[model samples]
Target chain A: MEPLINVAPYTGWVYPNETIFEWSVLIAVYPYLTGLVAGAFTVSSLYQVFGFERLKPVAHLALLTSLCFMFFVPLPLLLHLGHPERAFNATITPHWSSAMAMFGYFASFYVALLLLETWFAYRPFIVEKAQQRKDLLGTFYRILTLGSYDVSDKALRYDQKWILWLAIAGIPGAHGLHGYVGFVFGSIKAREWWSSDLMPVIFLFSAIISGVSLLAVIFVVSSKLRKIPIDLACLKGLAYTIWGFIMVALVLEGLEFANIVYKGREGVEMIMEYVTGPLLVPYFILQFAIGAILPFLWLSYMIWRGTTGRALIAGVTTCACLVLFSVFMMRWNVVIGGQEISKTGKGLLSYQMTLFGKEGALMAAALIIAPFLVLVVLTRLFPPWEDHAKSSSSLRSHA
Target chain B: MKKVSNPSLAARRSFLSKLARAAACTGALAGAGALGVGVAKGASAKTEAKPAAEGGSFPTKDYDWTKHQWAFGVDATKCIGCLRCVEACKVENDVPRNAHQFRTWVERYVYLEGEDRARIDSQQDPVNIAASGSEKEYRFANRYKDQKVDKAFFVPKLCNQCTHPACVQVCPVGATYKTEDGVVLIDHDYCIGCRYCVQACPYGARYFNEEHGVSDKCTWCYHRITKGMQPACVEACPVGARIFGDIKDKQSPVSLFIRNNRVQVLRPETGNAPNVFYVGIDKEVN
Candidate 1:
């Protein structure tokens, strides 16, 4: 068996127990998954709530993506927990003062909201599948329908209304959930790196960009898989969404960094040492320059040139992939970076991630991949595609 | 007014009765709270029934927690880096027998003749662990023995058990909480082992007990302190460097230590309002 604790190597003077990092890479994955949930929900809401017609093509995919990722959000946390069996203890007797105590409530409520909205958004598709087939797949759709088989114009209108309200409510539900994840770090007064009022806002904006970028990639990739011509208008809408949110994310992150430096709190010296030394590549080079700036500039160039057709699709897809990487790096920089700077105000510790263990790098990779695998199954069952959805709605109209 | 003989005796009796009544009320409340926590844990019913929840007024049946507000004091100037307190704490608390996990530990600070900063290392340091030659035992290595030492002192560190404890505040399940008498503790059975409290603590006093899958830290030896004895560390110290007492008694050793000297708590800016007081520690001791 592997050693239960992985002690980090350090420099300068850290507390004896500081050698063992409490939070690990799994903790970083928690916020990364939540940000994607919030971001994808944002895309669905753009069409459902604000009437972004150009975003209609990927809106159903957005809701499905959000739900799939939301289901897996708690897996990393459960795996990281020492007593996975007693995980519900937090919910049973939550300490009201703790920022973390609210996680169970927030996550549950958001999951319910996502499920309700996903059901309402796909109800038409489910009704059609339930009536059209008589196989095992048909039984699955029948169960998903929850016995509600109304396909009339009035019923469809009511469903649309419910979807709209759910999307409106989810705007705050999803974003608030992700922002609270930020509060979990920001409220920690011990670490100078995380104790900033701007942390939640920074996390909120980054969540928006990551979620939107995820939708852009999923939208482009699924279109190719179906051999369907990509919708330029919908892709542009996602690009614009990513472009808008990424700017805010970059600015908020910059200001958060500036606050840390300008305050020059007791631990700032070590933080400075960390950023210049071990943190230079992850924080600056990847999260900022290559991950963020390069994509931002690329999207801007494409938009300026009145880019269209295959060039636009390739450009946006590449940019979306970069933004996704950037957001993961952001979570890494926040969660792991906070731990790297010791609370001693005089030392730094480098976290050594192992290859195989309960909280190892391999498990982290598996978690990231698990959601996509679930999405593949979910998409097959629900078929959250634009042309299929349009035909189903039209079929309902003729009924 | 009615004529009364020996008025002072009557006044003293009245004061004693009020104190006793207050103590009884506080004890009742603490007992009820603990029972509530036990019932909550028992609701799950999967784990085999253990003894009455260890956290609530069960140990030392006659001990009254409400009457004592426990406090500790460290005279850093007097420490010899003997590592006795660290070993005693481990043996007494059954803390993990390893260099990385410590319930209580000591730090050695050395300021060379020309250096402005104090160099710091603890028994958990690889060099010192090597000197001890076993993970089960601990001792500070004499690494600085050959160098010309200018100024040096050993500062013994443990859980501060703060008045406004960050650890207790961040515990999601309230499995770890501040007792009425002032020591912060964890209910191993109830903790989800999320380790959030371990991160919130500024002093790095807390560690995850991997064996038990729960967060553990220096309780100031809650079991011993409640039984009217010195903590294991205090008893093990050869010199009078470690002090533990109830500050409620104005004449207790810890109370005197605070009154007779200028004292400081670690990381005062974190506003944890730590209960552990220190004397003869320099500015460099976070």
Candidate 2:
């Protein structure tokens, strides 16, 4: 039988209780999911509110992806709780001072906004299907229509207005949720790695890149699966989005690291040792070198050469995958990495990640994959395809 | 155009408006209900009477927490690295019988002949645990006996019970809280076990109690302290190294410890303003 707790081994003089790691791999997965939700919503809002016409092919798909990922955002957190049954206690009787107490309210509001926006965007499609088919699936669509089958030109215009405003409100609703996740870590004065004024902005930029990269990968994969011709312009638009945001993310991250090293506060020696020692591979090599810089340079080259067709598809998809991995590494470094350097300025504790437990790596992987699985089912049910978006021609016309 | 002039269309419009109004009314009622529940919970939590200290009650009889401002002090110069206080604390508090989880422990800082940094090792260090021969026992090893030590001293560490506790500030459900008489306590039943408080504590005093699924820390033995008795560690100290008393009395041990000596608290830079004072500890203690 396994022990109830996994005690981390330490080198120097860590506090005795610090041996047991509190936050696990599941905690890292939480922010990663929230970032993807915020990023995908950016793509949807770009088309609906900002009129980024070239991104039209993935606009509806983006909305659907955001909603699907948003659905599973709370699972990793809920699973990590010691008492999952009492999770509502934070929502019902919140402690106003805590940074974490506001999470319940922010997440609930964002989920509602995503639902409403997705409904308005799909109202035309739902009404059309409800009228054409009398099968069981049609019954599902008819109920989903909420009895407002008025698809007249005027009604369509009303729906368009609602969609535009909802997408606009969702801009802050999504990014605020992700930015707040950053504040939760940044505000803690305990860990030098997490405490910085630049933390929230860094998290925000990284979240944007991660979300956009996710949409790029999903758009290309789904297009290939459906045997549809990949839209070169839309793909280029995503590549450019990643290219722009990745630079900000990189700079913010670099500044955060530099501030830590330059400040050279009480625990700088231990941190320097940990980074150059145990953190060499995970932090420098995997996160910055391969995951971030390699993709960034590849995309820059592609853009410079005016790459198109199969070459663009291959280039952008690979870069998106790299960005996704890099962002996950960033979260891991911030969450687990902070804990690995003990609060006692004199020691280091290496987190022993397990394979099969509740807070294990396997569970973290499942939580990450669960969103895409839901997206597949949701796409099939709602048919957020570009060809089916004929009813809302205003959206396409803007494009 | 025909649909625009249809009379039934006007009727359908009225029905949809009614539907919208009805939905809005339900939403408003639900929101009010939620607020009502939240207010009620807050009120009950506030008004619940403290457990009286009567006849073997959990809190000692006639002990008023509001009237007493408790404080702790450590005189490291007097400590002998005996490990009795650590044993007494584990038994009294029922802390897990292991080398890792400690409510209070002793650190032996040794500076050998030519070292710039103090070689610090607590009783939880592996060699000491090996000397004790079991996780259930406590002892310090004699490994440093052969070394040419320039200086050495023992520092007993416990929760400082800061005036502005980072742990209490980060508890999402307000489960862990500061008491009126300067102590932090946890409501085990209410804690969601998110461990945010654990992460927020700079001193690393808080630890998750796996058995109870709640964060745990030294309360200065709140049950014993409220009963007008010393904390277990102070009572078990053989060298008069640990001191506990209410600063409300000017002549109390803790008050004199503060008034008579050049006392200091650990990590004053944290702005936590720790209630536990220390004397005879070096600059490298933190």
Candidate 3:
């Protein structure tokens, strides 16, 4: 992608007691996003693996979404690298122990898994297109098929079997993938808030919360775009999953704090400067109130009294809330809470957001904005929603 | 060999030495694929254990340096209600004269206004002592009880360039480093302007040099120290509150002072192992 020019850095300020370098938000954003992608992919695998017909519509869409976002996940960390060129060394000289180091292998396998699934899922369609003519599209499809363009029933059966198997296997891989992102922060013994093993569990749950919620909304939006009627069954089905995950996430969030406070770790009292202090507003108001509470209410209302349309709208709103709040608070908490206590454990520090040059803010902007741009491009080219039907019909009526 | 006459004891010593030698050789061979910096095994350890330069003098071994790198140390006990060191560091580092952003400071906890509601807070814009500014430039009588400073202690702060510097370890490109002489320095040239070092620093000493597009921290004055000079802040301290020198050298004033005084690193548990030692540090400090 040709990088966007003139993307300015957001206004970020330094706190008196904080470090001179602005690292928390910029560093945390990438992991937060990867968590979302991994969470969504895990949900997608459920339909593929367990034969939930309700989730069938999103089977291809989920794989494509996972593929699209995974491509961008490594870039933020890359730009953050002091030496971006030498980043490949992360793979070649893998520090297998460090969670950050294992990102290379996870990324490689995750991408391969997604790609293989996409190819197999879309193969019969491509093969059908290849049998038709001698144009560039035909050549492209033929190349995609690797000359085994025979549209045999047996080949389709085999592809379906493994795609289902791969999806099942990919579920745990995806969960582990995002869990590892949490492990990066949780493993660091230095920081107080991030150093809990429960963090990975919390992150995993939140990813499912955000990912599935976003998928519910996206499916509705896309169906409407193509003039397809809202799938009420799927909407209800997704809400049940969302409720399950959201409750899990809320408990996990509470458990994380309780674990810390209960243990009375040396750093716990200091970080309360966050729970009841600087982060109190963002934590309760935005993250809990809007992100978790409102969504749960709206979805619950729809589940109980309202129709599929209302449920879809509520789910969509919840996804927006969850996405924005989840990313915002994760960054805010990491950046703000990380700096609250003094290294000497003497007193509290403060922070005011500093927005200025492209060095910090613009780089982060490019990271987030660029992914949706890729998603848009992918939609234009492949159109994840229509792949199965279009390919099948074209192949059958090729007389 | 053993008791000056026992052959069995002599044989035992020889055999033990031979076993140790073999074990060390095997260990080195096992870790042959290991990479970078210091070697981990016996033959290499022997090569590394070069016996601290056998003669009267070599570069670092014989150098008398307690006078240079061991910068300002505060005696919280004998602070005498002074804030001169804080002012001195501000002037030296050219820190913006802000109420919040302090390079050095004094925190005052007072049971003022009423006895029931005790409160604690730091005073960044400390009032200077008007008259005999010698050692009493900072007086808090008006701010506390008896028109006198309340239960207060003036604890001066500065970046403790740690032994195992967290900031240095997390820097992606090795931008932050400790000098051979034991002072930490930030190299702006190789810094890609990433603030990982800044965030990782337990002391919060490292800061993004926004003006320079790179991270900067208390250098212990690399430009000055290398050429036999003291840091600006240490030089300007009026009350003899600041002492800059090498901790390694026994003869240096700092080494003697540290040995004589009950010096304490700010946050010993952070694992940074700060080189900065305060003689009379308080309980709660970051």
Candidate 4:
């Protein structure tokens, strides 16, 4: 295998040494952020779409979370593009064979659907509450109504049904949006670890886990903040759901690796570089043990004990692990690990993330944080739990 | 609405006879015209595109005609490792300050079983004609230390412009395209800043033009080829290790190389018909 360059005769620098695979970083962020949006929104929709009465308190909050992230999902890729202004051109002049090209239509359509769902879900609440305000928020909502603000029972029912059906259908669209991200990497035959049948299943499972966990944590936190009774039943059901998906996600990951190790290819040795090298700790410790096993055990223990408080805490903890570790690590492995192997197959290529490159960690942090800020502002404006029982007593206490 | 001066039956008959003759001539011309249209239609199926063809434009002829169009014919039998092509490419292409950003590149990997594997310091472009040294001499390289060294061979690198470019396939926007002449080109104006093509390039040949916000890759010196000049590297190589010409035109030097040698395309399994040929390619290069 005399390092494949024997014929071409290596002679010069490929590019400036300072740039260490900037493109891989961009790829990493698109799927990671999109997965979160899909997961978080799907969690928000569970109560609204599935008619789970207990999840009502956090239902609107979930929608807000989804909206915030849905907007940010495309930011990383946009920033990474050399000519971002021409990004819309992808949609207008799509090449059908390229899977990545399809993202343009899917993203735009999904955004429209999510926006309509968010608006219809909150339309009545907006019309009723807009009467008291002379502020910008109220004006936005008033304009949002297209000058036909109505709080009639029939109108509310119509809006609710519109939202319900949209939310119901939204599940597949969200899954497809997120699943396609996995499909892009999974379909790539160049990298062995990426080209796996379990990739889409892993994406879907992680989506459910991340989505459910995010809502559980947010709901619990908001309940405490507002001094309202937490919805114990919803948390329990969500914990069960999260645990089930986590189990599937973990199993799928195992199968992905087992199949590769079982029927080894030329790429196996190169992929092993991840095992014996830089990704070892991130893969084994963060992804497998602490991120996966600990959270699974904590949630399982709470689910069996019937202790609602413990379950909520464990659910929140699991969400923390998932957000901080799981999905991001999966992305890191695919983008960073996928490239670490050289074209020569002799050994690995050294690629460390640079601070100021287009795909740097600083850019990634900004992208991840931007959604939360958007979500917070939205929560303040709409206040998903503002109609809870506490308002009745506050008036009397003040008087 | 026009008035005829002659009112006699003979005058009217004369006008009718002339008009009838003109009408018959017009009818015969129209029939010939219709026949011509039919013939054109009959010829349509032979030339016009039909969807049922096994392949129209892509899964492209399973051979990259652009990058390898000037396929380098490195004869290992020809003994000499003068770094002339490397120097020429760096100076001509303005290769960056490091050995890693290799457009025309080379490396020597040494394998020793009992001893530690040895990598020779890349005989990087030494002419310094481009004044191409960084502050640190740009030390990012995968060289074996001064450890026990064994069998080593030199490999120079350039774009293999595969018929099926992974970069072209992955570009979200149809910004990157292969030219009719088989040269892969980036339509800078249409390129969205998405770097999928850069990542998807298996050869690591693609680089994002950070200044412009688009992926820029080797055009195999398209500018040079268009002007009847050899790629700077090929022109400068002292050993004639690099060959540049049209494979499509059999008389071209490249076609002669392909004709005379049992050459191999790197990573044929990738289905990217790499136009770059290597007479003595190692099996595991891809």
Clashes of 3: 29
lDDT tens readout by residue for model 3, A1-399? 112122112112222335333553456568667766875686677677665667766766777777777888887776655556655433433223435556666777777788888787777766766786589867877888887775577666777777777887788778888887777667655667677888888878887776676567667777777787766777677777777788888888888878888988665656675578667787777788777877777767777775556546656555555755664575557545665554434345555443443335666677766766787676654566644446532321232
The interface RMSD values of the models, given in order, are: 7.3, 6.4, 10.3, 14.6
Cα TM-score per model: 0.91, 0.93, 0.72, 0.79
Q: Per-residue CA lDDT of candidate 4, range A1-399, in tens? A: 111110112221222221345544656777777777777777656766666656666667777787787898887777766677766555544544677887866787788888888777666566655666788877876777777676566666667677778888788888899888888878776666677777877877777777677777777776777787777776776677678788888898888888888888776765676566767887777777777777888777776776667546656555555644776777777777666654444445555565665566787877777887887788776777746423311111222
Model 2 regions more than 4 Å off: A393-399, B1-61
**Cα-based lDDT for every prediction:** 0.84, 0.85, 0.59, 0.63
The regions of model 1 sitting more than 4 angstroms off are A391-399, B1-57
Docking class of 4: incorrect
In the order shown, what is each candidate's alpha-carbon RMSD?
9.2, 9.5, 10.8, 14.3
Listed per model in order, the count of residue pairs whose N, CA or C atoms clash below 3 Å is 1, 2, 29, 33
Determine which window of 10 residues in candidate 1 chain A has minimal summed lDDT. A390-399
Per-residue lDDT over A36-125 for candidate 1, one digit per residue giving the tens place of the 0 to 100 score: 999999998888788787887888898889999998999999998989997765654466688988787788878888899888878888
DockQ of 3: 0.13
Per-residue error (Å), model 3, residue A208? 1.5
Q: List the residue pairs that clash in candidate 1.
A: A39-A211
Candidate 2 — which pairs collide?
Answer: B53-B60, B53-B61
Candidate 4, A72: how far from true, in Å?
1.2
Better of 1 and 3 by TM-score: 1
